[model samples]
Target: MPLTRRSVMDAAAARFGWRRAYGTTTEVDALLTEQSETAYTASASHAELATAKNHDALAVQPGVLDVRGRILADVLYLEGVLTGARNRGLPSEVIERLEDVVDHGHELTVLLADAVRATAAAHTAGR
Candidate 1:
C-alpha cells in the first residue's frame, strides 16, 4: 500500500492517542536511533544463511522482495510513523539491515515454513 500523508495520519491517530505510542519525540528518536545502530552493526555469524543458500538468490529475488514489501507494508499499516523509522531520518545501518533481509529473505521464509511443518508433523505423529 502506498503510504500517503492522509492515510498515515489516520493510522497514526488510531494507533496512537492524541499523542503517540511514544511519550515524547525524544523517546521516539532515541528508539529509532538505537534500532538504526543495531541494524547498521555487522553480524558476527551468518552460518545458517550460508548453509541455506540452495537456490539462485536472483531467481528468488522477486518473491523475496514481495514478501519483504508486504512485511514493511504491515508495519506501516500497524504503526504509521515513518518520521522516525521509515524515511531518510532512519540511520544508514538500519537501511543496510533491511537490504540484507531482502537479500536473504527467501531463506528465512523457507526456514520459517520448515519450522511450522516440523511442528505440525510432530503434533500429528503424537496424535
Candidate 2:
C-alpha cells in the first residue's frame, strides 16, 4: 500500500510502543501522537485544497500553503526526536524502525506537496 500520513504515524507509534502501558503511557508515545495529529490535520487540509476546481478557488482558500508547511515542520520535528532517541541509546533495532518511519513520513510529506502543486497547476492551465 502507498505511504500516507496515517500509516507513517501508525508505524512510528508502534515503534515507540504507543499505548502499550497497562495503565499509563510514556512521553515518547504522547509526543508521537501529538506530532502525528498535527501532520494528519495538515494532510486533511491539503487534501481538501487538492479538490479545488480552479486556481482562484485554491488561492482564495485560507492557509492553502500552510498545509504543506505544517506537514513539513512536523516531519522535521519527528526526525529530530528520533535522532535524540538514538543519541540516548535506544535499542538499535527500535531506532532503525523509527528511522524508517521518519523516512516514510518525509516521503509522504513530499508526495502530498507535489500532488497539491500539480493540482494547482492543472487548475491554472484549465482556466
What are the per-residue Cα lDDT tens digits for candidate 1 across 1-127? 2226535865779786653355677767865776687766644344455446624334344444566566655544434433345665688776666555554654565664555556556556766
Give the Å error, residue 3, model 2: 31
Give TM-scores for every candidate, taking all chains together and pairing residue i with residue i. Answer: 0.30, 0.50
- In Å, residue 53's CA in model 1 sits off its true spot by 35
Tens digit per residue, CA lDDT, model 2, 1-127? 2337546866888998893322345545665677799889878867566567435645533454566678788879888979998889988887888888889878877876776777677678878
Q: Residue 112 lDDT in model 2?
A: 69
Per-candidate Cα lDDT values, in order, are: 0.55, 0.70
RMSD, every candidate, angstroms: 14.3, 10.5
lDDT of 1 at 4: 61
Off by over 4 Å in 2: 1-64
